[model samples]
Target chain A: MTPAVTGVAVTGVAVALPGAADARALLHPARPGAGPVDPAALIGRKGLRFKDRATQLGLHLAYAALSDAGLLQNGELTVRKDRLGAVVSSNLGNVDTVCRAVETISKESTSALSPMDTPNASSNIIASETAIRYGLRGPNLTVCNGRASGLDAIRWAALMLRTGRADHILVTGVEPDNEVTRRLVDGPMADGGAAVVLSRPAGTRARALLGPVLRTAQPADTAHQLVRQVPGGGLWLSAEDHPVPRSALRNALNSWGELSGALGVVQCAAAAGWFAEGNKSPAYALAGAAGAVLLAPEGTP
Target chain B: MTYPILGTGAVASIGADADAIFDSLCAGRSGLAPLRAFDPSRFNAQQLFEIDDRQTEGIDEPGRATRFLVEAIRQAAEDAGLPEDLAGIPVLVGTGLRELRTLELWWRDGVPLDADGLHFEDALRRHFGAVDTHTFAGACSASLYALALAWDLLELGEAETVVVAGCDVVTESMFGQADRVQFDPPPSVRPFDENRQGTILGEGAAAIVLSRSAPAGRPVRGRLHSVAVNCDAHHQTAPDAAGVEDAVRQAQAQAEVTPADIDLVVLHGTGTPLNDRTEAAVTARVFDSPGPALTGIKSLTGHTSGSAGLLSLIVALRSLERGLVPPIAGLADPLPEAAELRLVAGGPLAAPLRLAQVNSFGFGGVNAVAIVGGAA
Candidate 1:
């Protein structure tokens, strides 16, 4: 049975990484339509130590979601040992580190490769590091299904939770664009990690409103627009900001400038941005990568 | 809830299926042969349970690891009897190398090699998109972890039937690890015996179709109870002896079966001194009785890396089916520490067994254990 999503909620979500926020300013220049914004040189230096471009953006978005949800406590993020798992999506990881490792592995095969480079090379480094530092010990998966890996990871993470493999789930979709990564993402790319905190249905009014994502079919007409495409087994969707946020799901090209991978981050970005107040019988709908929608709040089902 | 072991098939030098291999193992025959992939030149010792192209022939070309998967999977699928909802089946294939030959050839020689590591997944996806297929690699524990993933999928109801496969073909680069890694003994692999050397690299493919119900094909041999995989975070190559033992106990406990219930044990014997001794000690600690009739397969098959776990389990099942345990092929001298265990040396021995445990511990401290019992 494709279990119906009874409730759609977010609890505590935090972004704790070394250098994600500040590096983003250098990369997230305003596109033609998003209105004029001073480029990185004009933005004040928020210190280089904290921003890994993508992680930095992840921090703000994730922090805002958690803080907005009123779930923030001591900065110390704690999760159940086995029930806590993290799913993070990324289009481009630490490309600088990847390129460095490639050069070193290829040219410096005889010499000892840098231990420092190993962590960054792993596609799931963000999830691994986050869980290690945050004390979460559950299912952890990272996917790089082109730009849609983030959404795909979240979709799977939710399935994990729905299947009772995990209790509270951490879904983070991030894409940090780097110069070296551009070679890989020559078509399009972006920077940021979008995270969502999910829990079991609490049967509250908030559970009644949001409808279940019945099906998330392959991005209908949107698949044709992407510059770089890979046919991996995961769901790939690009989200474009609608004329109004959440007004309707917009394809990547229309949203924020074709958020190829950014669409995955946008799934939660759009969900987290929802200012849905109290509505006891909240309806929830979880759409999959291939247009399979699962409605929640089984009481009605 | 016991996860049914629907159907299993393995491709190795010994035999492609259980019938031929079981007889071979029973007669104390060995499959370990010199490296056939390339010329065995100045390298120290080159023996492995090499696979014949007979198993993977028309399914794939060029004898690549991923192609090995195709071959083994084809047989396993045929053995699985072909479920109606083939689309919903989950394909979980394990590999330590991740098409290492392909990766190496691509990186070093710039030949496209085998695209199975990253591309064949798409083939499975397109063929079985309604079905979920995933690939996992963690050096040696690849298939064991895949087994665990199969269990999780069954438990999670991701699919009613899941195919867990492990495959690896020796690559020149992988062959170099024995020398590159400092711990292995010189050249030869001698498990549980004094003066034991480290593991000799080997490769093959084994796949088991897992499901919630008894498969219509063959009578099931055993049921997979539980699986546990843990990281040492201690070191890259070395085993946290304590971690290994704990993982074993935890997996058994999670399966809710005591060690006393097990009649046989399949060790991840790499034949390295550290491994043999540590595995024996861990077995002593986990098993209620000493060693539980120790059996090692590497002496006959070398080390198949990711496929080792499934390979060993298949051998164990073969032993169970014949109601006799196979001997450890190359134990020259009895190791002092492993003396208590009844080692089936030189040839196969008769034993009534119902339950068993298997281990697959790999580099980067990845460890996995699976407990299988007579079908419920």
Candidate 2:
């Protein structure tokens, strides 16, 4: 049975893509290989020196989104910590850490493994670190579903809210550029991430309402379903690594290169930004096979 | 909005089937033995509870962990009486560290690595025809995370049937890492016992089928009442007693039951000094003096990493059905100072079981708890 559409709204969003600081910049690429943003420069340098790039990018986007939502003032959270939950998704979690562990064990002995680096090897530690930093005590999860992870994270967070598990949730996706993932995938790899702060529908500062999400066996079918569900002149953002063909609807790639797990949320943020502007047309962000999310701006017919 | 656990299956070091495994666990049999699949001479720990792939039926491949997962999922679906065509069913799996044995072999002997096997996600798609598949990689707590996600999907009415599974193999990489970090318990594992050293690595797979309603013919084991997930925000390997206590309290409140209603506590019990101590401290603080009987299955099956939590859940449900709690293997002498928890030792204790709680904590401050109420 398909669950009811969550009456949740995406109040604020932030993105840190390659060569782009914000979502608008993300839509318009500047040059070849935007390169990763210096995470320390954006979110301070202390204690972040040894942290993996994934964590740095995730933290940067989350803080930026929360800041945009007015939840953070004077570098402090105005919302209750226990009421906040976080769901972070990534395809290749801390690949650099895993590679480093392999290098260390190869060079010396297994005992030479750094204690600090050992725990970071786990994928979920990125989300855990974020929670620890902000003291968010609500439901915390890390989903690693390859390219579709970002959309799955959003859907899961929405379910948490619908079930009264949390009042607010930070839905995020982050994947860093690394040689290991580069060798595995075919397209241009990039380090980028996007975060969206979701809250109950009755709350203020609503940017867009989260429409029903469709999970089908085929990406094209899911796109068609989204079109039928929200029939209008809206943009269809494809965040998949592979091209999704949908000639019937106005479709476009994320264009910020291949962010893998980070692409889905980035696409959602882009659609939200599109609606945030005067454009009343609804938008849907579709991820790798089976994950698609629709966003309808407030007051949309 | 709770959901019923329709059926369960397992492929562990103890046994391939859940009922046989539970019987062995009740009989106080240990699957811990010397590591044979790989050479563990360099590591401080020389033993592991390794499951022989050759012995595991339906395991076509030789060394890949994917085979174990496939076999386990098939057994679980069959046990649950799921239709043959499971095209759209959601499959949530918890997978541990990447299988690096092929790469390690390539690095050591210059042998060409076999890249034929699929990753965890691909394997699920190919094996079970799962379309909406989500894999969780949270180190040791991976299976618990998967189970929690399955619970949410069922409660939210998003999925009528969800398959939650987890699998990991005893790779050389895991042994090396465990040995380097001093997480290896030499000789054998001893939980909540004085002079306890640490945990031993194990390999296996376990799967459970959950549905919004009960299946026909098969008795409902229990209803997954609530799931509470949190992070310690503390150290990586070491757990904060306060964080664990908070998770327990939150889980109880969500289940709408106090600690007094719990009949058993299935602990993570990695058998490591830090993990056992922290869990004991947390349990003592949360449950009453003669609180829910504390028991652990790791002493018998070893720590199966990603699959440990699901295995614990299977054991707890079986205990609820049989009204008996299995003894904590290798726990000869209970620690006198840590007497706050009523640790179940000696042998299987026959009691009226109703509600069971399972606790799972991973390397990275990830804490997940689930409360299950036995069927009426």
Candidate 3:
């Protein structure tokens, strides 16, 4: 049996989806044909030129999440640099940059490649950039583990807190809808970012307590297993096309479109919002290959 | 909460299996050769550590990286005497450029792109019947990150057994980028050498099977004592000595061992000027004068990128089993800063190895260090 992850609480939540003002908007169905995200409007114009779309989206959400957690004030961190950690998940975060660079190299000479853009080719740029911008000197990790990346990032952050590696961890999942990503996947994609601030439940108001993530190879099995853990009258959120019968189950993918790497975090943000609205039942979020996480409202043992 | 290393596997330019690679290392064979996977005339540096085409002939359809990874996992499972149907065992793969070569080929040759092959989960599911798979892309330190997470899973009782693997293949995009960045790139990689030019990309994969409990009737390869990961939050391309030092200190602290107790140190010597210097400085600050015997395999294997971490760990474990530390393949004149440290060179050094430390630092200031104890 996997040990229960106790004392880790979600203190803050933020999302940068198109047509969504706050996390609560995610609880409702997403607006039809939402316009593309404008990260410049949310964050700023400066430092937006060199960053890729995924990084831009991630930065905006991280800033908002940090502020919501009361850890950031006026663009400055309120906690020690070493006590803060950052983990970002995106399966196709840097695909556009990488594909563009590859195209340039194939068509033009190596000399045509800009040195400034070389760093963006690295997959961990988003996570590292977030840490550098926020002065998060603690353990930084980037998860690109396919569909499970977002939830895996959350699980990794929880382990970091459980092992006393960091007092607080900023977890963000972002995916960009661009020429390359569109070519890779079919159908409209949920191209945005979502972030949650997970920290040890000490001296902080907890919005919800995170339970251990249960994983299985098959999506149907994972959904069934996840549903078995929570009590009755809980709201279940899943992106998989599993046929699990539940009284109050919602497929975020149907409502928000295909979120890819951002689905898990978006589902998590929605659950946190659900709790913030004074709901008492435990909320569950499950992504097909990513497994499931149970979010219990505050004061749950 | 130490996890026992039950089995090991590897596929590199030097050899196909873990034991063969270790033997090649002990014999001081360098895998550096002219790049044959792609046209090398376009790049300033023409040399790389590329695996033989014959080895991946049958399984090179989707990508050579996947081929190497699948081969490595098969070897690891076979070595651990695991069932043919892996059923519920979870797989965690670390990679820098997952299927980028395949994507590049598709773009260049107009081949039909199969999105399923872009990630390792499908391949794992087909090959080993692995249902749960996690692919980490943390650059060069990716596999170590996966290994660290594997350890966490075992420690938390998430799974009794876990498969950790890392793989990457040389892509034209990376080659072109390196050609532009490296100043007068040399044909060979020479770590710790004063004239070390830059890293030569390598293609390969390595895997290790770790278990919470020792496998019944099977000899344990080693015990993973601790793994410490951190970020400099300093630079994207440049490594920070402070971050590297912190990781080394934290690993030693978690393992409850002093520098003197470690018999060997597998340096993440990328052969890049800044990286080697930063690593040497960190080594000097952490250990006493002429610290534990240090060896950099990149001089022979070229920087394997994502798989480099596990390859180094495998070398350390092999050193523990064979009592022979492989020498740095192409080191003649050590950097003046690294002179105080014991940089093994010329030939393999015989020693009664017990504890070994492996360092793997990557782009974006990502750093991971692992300390492993040999089963004597």
| Number of the top-ranking candidate, with lDDT as the measure | 3
Docking class of 2: acceptable
lDDT over C-alpha atoms for residue A197 of model 3: 92
Q: Choose the strongest candidate by DockQ.
A: 3
Looking at model 3, the pairs that clash are: A217-B131
lDDT of 1 by residue, A1-301 (tens): 3233434344433322222222122122334443222223322344324335554454344444434334333654444455665555554444454445434444535133443344343333455454444444555444444433444555555555665656666666666655544444344344454566666553331211122222222444223211112111121223323111243333232223324444444444333222222112211212223222212222332
The DockQ value obtained for model 1 is 0.11
- In the range B256-321, model 1's lDDT, one tens digit per residue, is 988788788888888887777887777766765454777877776678887888878777766666
Candidate 1: interface RMSD in Å? 6.1
Q: Which of 2 and 3 is the better model by TM-score?
A: 3
C-alpha positional error of residue B238 in candidate 3 after TM-score superposition, expressed in Å: 1.0
TM-score of chain A of each: 0.62, 0.90, 0.92
DockQ comparison, 2 vs 3, better candidate:
3
Cα error of candidate 3 at position B308, Å? 0.6
